[model samples]
Target: MSELSLKVLAAGSLRAVWQPLMTSFTLQSGIEVDTRFGPAGLLRESIEQGERPDLFASANIAHPQRLKALGLASRVEVFTRNRLCLTARKELLAAQPSWLALLGNRALKVGTSTPLADPSGDYTWQLFDTLERHHAGLGEYLQQSSLKLVGGPASQSVPNGELAAAWLIRGGQCDLFVGYASYARRLRLCKDLAVIDIPENYNIQADYAFAQCYEAANPLSDFLLSTAAQEILFREGFARNL
Candidate 1:
């Protein structure tokens, strides 16, 4: 029997959830799965640069849509959803401050992924914009003051497989980080981090999408949206499609 293999490029936020699912998939189908995880935009850039992968999964719909427009992939499909959260050291909540008070505190350091290079950062900026409508100049203040800790040109040197947001908070590099709620949930379990909920009005939904780059049928893509896959995603904190 000839060996079957697949190359998959996926977003970093899917790291923890994808492994077990893929392992199950491989065991059942006898297909080898090779995954390269990173920021979705960066992965898209690589695809544009001719890094061909059988599948491309992104944290946002925009990246896959762009690839589809360019004829590099098939139609984009929403696989799962996620939302942003504010993660910080547990000690920061000792005073039990409100989300707004903590975010507006100038003395505390804030961290976010790089806009354009990572969807999480763009969503965070959108949240800032919503804040600006209620409190003038708040958006601009966060854009200027918040540190671009990961998922940008500066993060090129950061090792792969490391969760940038969690790492930054764990290393004392930032007092707070705006990242995926799913990621924050995972980090809170094993680390000294706390997950803070953003107001619903200011929150953004992260719709994860994927498409096959080649013309062949992709079982993995179909499997991702299947009941088994969605169950895992939901358990891992991803929102299910209605």
Candidate 2:
């Protein structure tokens, strides 16, 4: 198989947890692994266009499900899980702010990935939907708040990495970054950032899935589903489907 070079398309949030293992995968297996990381939807679109990726790993389960149902990727495997959280600059955390506090703070700017292009953004919409069900004022709050302090507007590309939501806060551009707590867990480089574990009511479970693409010609696709690969994957923040 021409010495197996696996092209993996995954979420940018995975950079920290996946790099170490991918390095190990390369060294031990002598397989060249090339990765493209970004919002989940964008990556999937790339694969859909016949990008010839060997394996597709995503932060959300829905996209893989869609691909499986559409016959784009075969042998879908549920690999791991994750969830979202709110991140803000440590200086702004005051006596445990609530979602109400998050929406009401006029001085604070809130940013999220684009719902149409990023799953994280979609989760934020779901959170807002929950808020709207009870806090009808929240719908107005979002409209007003979006107009009041956005850096233009919320988008799929949040200036940088998916977790750059912290950057939005640290840079004095925003107050709260709606993002993944586990994804934001390891960015020691971001100073003075504090995280709030999203309440159960606001939480959305993320199940990561991997599928072997039909056009993928790499043997590493099979290897990635192997016990050895899964062990590395487990350490990289994914739980088994079962």
The sequence of per-residue lDDT tens digits that candidate 1 reaches over residues 1-242 is 12488888999888889988898778767788889888888999999999888889999999999999998998689999999989877877887567787888888899998899988888889888888998888778998899988878667445555666667877877899998988766676755777888878888999999978864437788788888888889898898865
lDDT of 1 at 81: 94
After superposing candidate 2, which stretches have Cα over 4 Å from the reference? 1-3, 143-163, 187-191, 214-242
How many clashing pairs in candidate 1? 0
Q: What is the C-alpha RMSD of each candidate to the true structure, in Å?
A: 2.2, 3.9
The residue pairs that clash in candidate 1, if any, are none
The alpha-carbon deviation from the true structure for residue 37 of candidate 1, after best TM-score superposition, in angstroms, is: 0.9
Candidate 2: tens digits of C-alpha lDDT, residues 216-237: 4245555555677667656655
| Whole-model lDDT, model 1 | 0.83
Model 1: CA > 4 A from native: 1-3, 156-163
List the candidates' TM-scores in order. 0.92, 0.79
- Candidate with the greatest TM-score versus the true structure: 1
Backbone clash numbers for all candidates listed = 0, 4
lDDT of each: 0.83, 0.66
